[model samples]
Target: MAVPGWLDDTRTSYDTVAVSYADLLRDALAAEPFQRGILALFAELVRAQGPGVVADVGCGPGRITGYLDGLGLDVLGVDLSPGMIGVARRDHPGLRFEVGSMTRLDLADDSLTGLLAWFSLIHVPDDEVPGVLAEFRRVLRPGGVVLLGFHAGDGSRLKTEGYGGHPMHVHVHRRRPERVAAWLEAAGFTVEAELTHRPAPDVEGGFVFAHR
Candidate 1:
């Protein structure tokens, strides 16, 4: 089942965990070349397009959002977890951070020039992904870009570490790149790029770039 609880509690757990193991999380990410490359590419795209504003959906702790901001894009960070939003706000006070769900963003239609969903949809139940994509389509302006990352495989159950010694489990419905590409096309995005790489332990994922 989807997480029906308030996003605040989920974020609180992440905040607690981050406070104790910030360095651990930081060091662990250093091993992720695929992730690094994905972010680099997205930054390059934003620079190339010169988008005025961007939204980082499911922006946990503001890492990707901060990267986008560094590229000079007006970036807004949104996530469902309050703890994550709290951490993002505390860590990057200059940027805007909001507690919001991807399925139902609190923004006007065609308000964004770019959108990034790196590793954000991994936990969303498969049936809900299309709706989330529809929401993405709603907020993005024509010629806007979207960068999405997801684990590569068939649908399955998985667990990953959450905040403060807690375990977060969810149904991970992985899809082939072609299938996702088709879905994005159906949702009004044109495929621009797609790449797959395994750069960290237990992470098998790929990224897709699409333009609205």
Candidate 2:
């Protein structure tokens, strides 16, 4: 399938700022206790089923991927930006990082034990989210889990600049947690838990844990 225009734009934008983005978020997990807790829970759930691979989709710089690795999960990172993948590989030499898209994963059906879409779906257009979620569903083994983190809101915002004022060309789309749950259900996932929290005073974070 040809890459969607928006996906191409997002890939280009991230590639342009991959270095800066990596530097800025390299140590972010250190301060995020809630996110870490969620990740621990996710790791436990995936490990309960048996030994299998986990794909960290849109794993910029591989921080979460590396973290999951430390938790003893066989995890690989994938992103649309080759530059980001390069940084991820460089930063975590032991783990695998590759250039790939969430919209159409290259893996075989029922291959993954778990998938993490950690705040990465924000760049995807609202209309395309279902297809992406379906792709996530397609790649997972039965009883596999997926964890999604995204901004909670009712609309989209065009991010013009980020990471030390570098120009960006992506629209960050926020969705209600209920709406996202509906999408996951449509994609054949059973919603396990939904969390909405304020990581910062101004930012609302949404997390959904679901099973296939």
Model 2 lDDT tens row, 105-140 = 999999999999999999888778889999999999
Q: On residues 1-212, what C-alpha lDDT tens digit does candidate 1 reach at each position?
A: 35544244444445556554443454444577667767777777766776567899988878778867876788999988777787788888999999888989999998988899977787676566788899999998888889998877676665456446665544456767777788798887899987777666866787899989
Model 2 misplaced regions, further than 4 Å: 1-4
How does each model score on TM-score?
Answer: 0.84, 0.97
Residue-level error in angstroms, candidate 1, position 166 = 1.0
Cα shift from native, residue 106, model 1 (Å) = 0.9
True lDDT of residue 160, candidate 2: 84
**Candidate 2 worst ten-residue window by lDDT:** 1-10
Candidate no. 1 TM-score? 0.84
- The residue pairs that clash in candidate 1, if any, are 11-83, 12-83
Superposition-based RMSD of candidate 2 using all C-alpha atoms, in angstroms: 2.2
Clashes of each: 2, 0
